[model samples]
Target: MWGRVRKSWSTVRDAFRTERDTGRQARSHNLFEAAAAYVSACAEDDQERIEEAAGWVSPEALSFGVNELACRAVIALARERDESPRAVARDLLGLPAA
Candidate 1:
């Protein structure tokens, strides 16, 4: 399901963000995290907004976008599901989806 993709991307994005901005040393990896974030966010949002923004990012371009979007998507989904964001992320990430 979309949840897996969203979860994986969110994890990657968060990792990258922590490395890049949370006083770590993984700057190079941050770009990938940002890209994954973008994919997840774009997929979870309202269709109208996605459509409007779609034109701005080609599939190729999205590959290079920031993973922050994925972080955003998982957050949104967690809110919609009314459950623990970490639990949902773990489920989607294939960490025992209980």
Candidate 2:
């Protein structure tokens, strides 16, 4: 799963680079927009949308945005369930409790 993620990220990076080289206007999408679209696309398994969202920002920027989104999501879930963030994250991933 992670390997596929890396591959897709790299593909986006390459496409962005090509677009830059072509002197095209950069997308106006903010980090949050890219994050939301990317995550939703991933949830729906929409590769086209994922690539489109990825193009909205640099790979590193997109990564940071995604990380922020995940953190916020975990915090929200923890609050809703009255559980610790760590516990919620572990449960989300189906990991054994420590």
lDDT (CA) per prediction? 0.58, 0.85
Q: By summed lDDT, which 10 consecutive residues of candidate 1 come out lowest?
A: 13-22
Residue-wise C-alpha lDDT for candidate 2, range 1-98, written one tens digit per residue: 99999999998765334332237765366777889999999999999999988887788778888999999999999999999999999999999987
Model 1 bad stretches (over 4 Å): 1-65
RMSD of each: 14.9, 9.5
The alpha-carbon deviation from the true structure for residue 4 of candidate 1, after best TM-score superposition, in angstroms, is 45
lDDT of 1: 0.58
- Candidate 1 similarity to native, TM-score: 0.35
Model 1 C-alpha lDDT per residue in residues 1-98, reported as the tens digit of each score:
89999999987655434332446743443444445544555668656555433334444444445445557767899999997888778978889756
In model 2, which runs have C-alpha deviations exceeding 4 angstroms?
Answer: 1-27
What are the clashing pairs of model 1? 33-67, 34-66, 34-67, 35-65, 35-66, 35-67, 37-67, 37-69, 37-70
Q: TM-score of every model?
A: 0.35, 0.73
Clash counts for the predictions, in order: 9, 0
Backbone-clash count (model 2): 0
